[model samples]
Target: MPESLEKHGVSVLVLDADGTPIATVQDALDLLVSASYEGAELVAVPAGRFDDSFYDLSSGLAGEVLQKLANYRLRLAVFGDISRHLRASKALPDLVRELNRGRDVWFVTDLDELDARLSG
Candidate 1:
């Protein structure tokens, strides 16, 4: 599926197509390219876009994907409540907390929150 573009406040962002799971590094690369093609500075992705292994830090999928996005200087706004994953793993919550504190990555509860962050 192709990426979808949306306006969040004044900022335009690319969103992952529904049902597309970013399961590997290649997926991250594709997402970056799509975002670039859409002329978006950020990408709003649902937590469900990630594969199960992404929550399993040991699999390194999450870190690898984040690295790719960082290298491309793209911002990622993960929009969803990942409370279940936080409960399932001790490390993920801390990692998410740190990421949310940074400029490049943000774990947001919803699109409106992401839009607020983009605007404010």
Candidate 2:
């Protein structure tokens, strides 16, 4: 079952344990549909739900998925430790920093941080 949080007219759906890895735009679409069905404006996901390629800037999967989510006007928060990937790539940290600056997407370290963000 999906966990949820509601405050300030925003509802967030926290992806359940064993969330499926996002491999394509369709995967992101599916999550959007699911979030809509749950009446959630934001979807809180764990970083592990994304494929390795999603972290590889050359693959373009990250941009595509995030764009799809943004096009739908749904906020996405990816919570977890992505430090290894950050350490491996030169561009990822900057990408993450930029993404976090926008209201449409965020990368957080834990649920409490995500909660604080969503609450705001």
Report the number of the highest-lDDT candidate: 2
- Model 2 per-residue lDDT tens digits across residues 4-117: 778557798998648678888789888888998998988888889888888889899999988888888889888999999999899999999998888888999988997787
Clashing pairs in 1: none
User: Which residue window of length 10 is worst by lDDT in model 2?
Assistant: 1-10
Q: lDDT of candidate 2 vs native?
A: 0.86
- Over 48-93, each residue of candidate 1 has an lDDT whose tens digit, in order, gives 8888898899999988998888888888888887889889998999
Model 2: colliding residue pairs: none
Q: lDDT at 12 for candidate 1? A: 49
